[model samples]
Target chain A: MKIAIDAMGGDHAPEEIVKGVEMARDRYPELEFMLFGTESEVKPLIQSMDRLELIPTTEVIAMGDEPVKAMKEKQDSSLVQAANAVKEGKADALFSAGNTGALLSSAIFIVGRIRGVERPALATAFPAFGGPHREFVFMDLGANAENKPSHLYQYGILGTFYAESVMGISNPRVRLLNNGGEEDKGDDVHKAAHQLMKNTDAFNFLGNVEAREIMEGTADVVVADGFSGNATLKAIEGTALTMMGQIKEAIKGSGIRGILGALMLKPALKAMKHKMDFQENGGAVVLGVKAPVVKTHGSAKANAVANSMGQIQTMVEGKLVDKTAEFIKENADKLKVKKAAK
Target chain B: MKIAIDAMGGDHAPEEIVKGVEMARDRYPELEFMLFGTESEVKPLIQSMDRLELIPTTEVIAMGDEPVKAMKEKQDSSLVQAANAVKEGKADALFSAGNTGALLSSAIFIVGRIRGVERPALATAFPAFGGPHREFVFMDLGANAENKPSHLYQYGILGTFYAESVMGISNPRVRLLNNGGEEDKGDDVHKAAHQLMKNTDAFNFLGNVEAREIMEGTADVVVADGFSGNATLKAIEGTALTMMGQIKEAIKGSGIRGILGALMLKPALKAMKHKMDFQENGGAVVLGVKAPVVKTHGSAKANAVANSMGQIQTMVEGKLVDKTAEFIKENADKLKVKKAAK
Candidate 1:
């Protein structure tokens, strides 16, 4: 399987990207990489070009650049070219650690969405600490500022497919992210979505799941409108970061006891951080697209990039996009239903 | 000043409720409490009758009872009667450590909304670490499953008054809790809310704030539509609880070193927990009501109950309801504007 790499993406850019490519290439013998970046800069960072082929390109999409505008203007940019490689069938999947908005734009507008998909959702298998499952798929994580109830219903389908095809979860249990655990909770959009999802024989519909229960592994796939999804994801992340920061402060302020405790608890703390790290689950997959379009955090190191490559390899091997397209085609009528319209 | 209390409405009920009342009664010589509950079950828990009066009631609103349904049927319930006391001007405020929904229902239906307020918000002063403030007020926390742009704008005013009158923060900075930090991020309602707030000369409007920044005290008061607010609040809470649980598990699984670390880190962990505890800041206030109506956790102990009393005292002393009413009267035209219609 071949993966198109936007080597000029991310804060670490060509250096980390090249190192990650090298790592992934060495680990998976069947995998090949088409690294896109400025030849002069990215060429020297390459350790071994055995399974890695450098497809040089100019222009870099900065983190702050407007997504759609940048994609339109930066035609020769590595991100755009890399996306084009997948669209042209030269690569099985597209991977980047660049500006999230830009990569999303490239994934949606460049490689394109699946036939019936109105919006391609950004899905990630976040860690589920206390639940039976180690991780569960959550989607529409800020892909769009707004989403219709029908879009949420679509996310359930997309998320279900991702979990089944990629994560190997059989009959993935899908649930709507609601204000309360009850069926009759949430706003008009969510209430309508609950009814829509509950009535469907599409996947394993397990009713509504609250934000407080997401980490508890209440369901295999949690669907949400983009706005709430974004807020929920960020809140969970922010809380974890803040608590850990507070612990660090407590240790520093505690003097001798804290120093000794820190040394003794180093392993436990290390394990916790590792579990919480995005690198553990690779990057987010922009599902409902024609091909696997993945993105790691911009600050992701070589390990994270390598993990993303492994994730992409699984998606490619499992034929997630193809399977999703087939499923959407089969559920054509359901996908087109406007029952959730206000 | 007099305060009505729902002594029968909690997991620990009359015992914890009476204990909390005694703590508050002893602390505040000028304050009076009107406790409503089953006389047999509650009379034994009372230590002092000075400044504490028990009003016997027959019905008990169960945790699972529907809010509005229970409110109408269980008229003589502790929660309902306490709310009624506030409504009839027999009590200055209403406090409960019971069914949040029931309390909110009673507050809205019985205590009533302040003159022109459309929806009352559940406002809580959650702790803020690594910032300029100890805690910042967050509103519309599941009070309404849906909130209009005008409601969000009203939260700004209500939250500002709570900060100023209750918490003594003057010219409090209010921000809209949005999907992104940018001024132009979020759904139609939030986008419209941003525009509405930005143009208003009524309050100190500080653009948009993401859920990630709430802990960092990006704003003194954060306004959000009820749905997003509920999601954000739960996400923050769930994350904290989950992380703490994970840390405990880590410590337990780490053996001798972990035990020693736990002992040394005891004080630091305690301090962190204290800072994060709801007891430290009291319960959520049902704002935009005719009078202060508060609800603490159902499992709250004596200390938490006492904290709520102190919070109620501040609200009453500051004349939060009267001041909010005055402000609403001044900004009547702004409050009634429905610019966020889809």
Candidate 2:
């Protein structure tokens, strides 16, 4: 199995990307990588030549560049070339730690969407609180600004398949993210989506789950329209950040005794932080694409990049994308958007 | 100023309600309260009825009961009677620590909507991370499931007036709660709302703010469609609860030294918790109503109940509801929904 890497992407760029690629190459016996970046920048960073093929590219997509515009203008950029490698079937999957918009663009427009899939969703795994499954997948993390009931239903199936095949959860329970946790509690779109999901025999349909109940691991997969999903996700992240920051301030403001107390409790706090760390789940998968495309964090180190590569390898080896494509293709009628009637 | 109090509501009803009413009556020299509840159950709890009047009500609206149905059927309920007092001009404002949905029903159908107001929004003040203003008001916290650009525009005006009149924030910044921070970042509804707010010479429109920036106090007033508002609010609350729970577990699971350290940090942690508590900001206001109607937490104690009454007193003394009604009525044309034309 082969994966195309956008070597010029991320904060660490060539050095960390090359090191991570080498780590994954040594780890996976049958895996190979085609690194796309400036030759001089990426060449010396590589520790081993074994199973690593460097494909030089002239242009680079900066973090601030407009996604669609950059993709069109920067034809020789590493992100573009890496996406092309997957499109041409030279590689089984694509991986990047670049700009999220650019990576998503590469996944959708370049690598292409699977036949019958309306829109690609960003699927990220998150830590769940005290359940059999310590983690759950949240889909459509701001991929599409607006979505029809059909797209939401499709996300239900896509997320379910991802959990079963990639995360190894059998018959994953799928829940629609709603404002209130009830059968008929939501806006027109969510209420319609709930009905659509309930009627289908595609996956294990759990009823609506509220944002508050998400961390409790009530559902293995939480599906939402991109706008609400993005807003809610940020709320959780922002709240957590604010609370932690305040705690730090409190500890500092409490003077010597409090500082000494915090010092002794470092291990416990570290453990909590480790559990909350989303990076341990690897990068987010731009699902519904023809091939597996994962986007790691921009500030990812060698270990994080290697872990993302491992996730990509699992997706490719399990043929998760192929399974999703075939399923969607077969159920195109059910997944078709019909909101105009509403 | 006279405020109608719903005595037979919340977890600690009658007892806490009466105590709080007495506290507020004592604190505010000219304040009088009409306590609505079953007289037999309420009168014994009142230590001194100097300015507090106990009005007998036969029925009660349980939290589990349907809001609209309860409002329609339970006419003699405390929540209904208190709201009726406000509507009949027997009381200057209304206060309830009851079922949010039921209180909202009373506020709308009984107290009535402010003229030209499209919808009544739930405005709750949350503790900001750190700023000149430690608290910021978030509006439309699940009052209307869906909202047009016009409703969103009105939320800006309503929320701004609220901050100025009640919270005492001079030239309060009003921001549209969106998924993205950019001016052109949201979906159709939000994009149009941004345009509407930007074009109008009504309030201080500070463009769009993502859910994450909310706690940072980027704006004094953050307005959103009810669905997004509810979801985001719950996410923030849920994440905080989860993190605190995890920290408690960590402290408990830690060895003797860690536990000792945590014990020493109690004062500091308490300060942090105090800062994070939303109850200090009083109850949520059902804005765009004829009178200042507020709903405190269901689990509110005497202190919290008194605090909310203080908020209501401020709103009443400032003629906030009347000011809001006049402003919205004057700007009816600008706030009219024309999305069908779009």
Question: Which candidate leads the pack in DockQ?
Answer: 1
**CA deviation > 4 Å runs, candidate 1:** A336-342, B334-342
Chain B alone: TM-score in each candidate?
Answer: 0.97, 0.96
Worst 10 residues of 1 chain B by lDDT: B333-342
Question: Residues B1-342, candidate 2, lDDT per residue (tens digit)?
Answer: 889999999999978988888888778887899999998999889898798888999999997788999999999999999899989899999899988999999999999998877788999988878678978889899998888888888888889889999889988988899977777777899998898888778889988889987899889999999998998998988898899899899999998977998998888888988877887659999999899999998999999999888888889888898888787777666565443322
Stretches of model 2 off by over 4 angstroms after superposition? A330-342, B329-342
Q: In every candidate, how many clashes are there?
A: 0, 0
Best by the TM-score measure: 1
Query: Candidate 2: what lDDT?
Result: 0.88
DockQ of 1: 0.83
DockQ of each: 0.83, 0.83
Q: What TM-score would chain B of candidate 2 score versus the native chain B?
A: 0.96
| A131-246: candidate 2 lDDT, tens digit per residue | 78978999888988898887888898889989988889999999999987677888888988898888888889988988988999989999988998989888988988898888
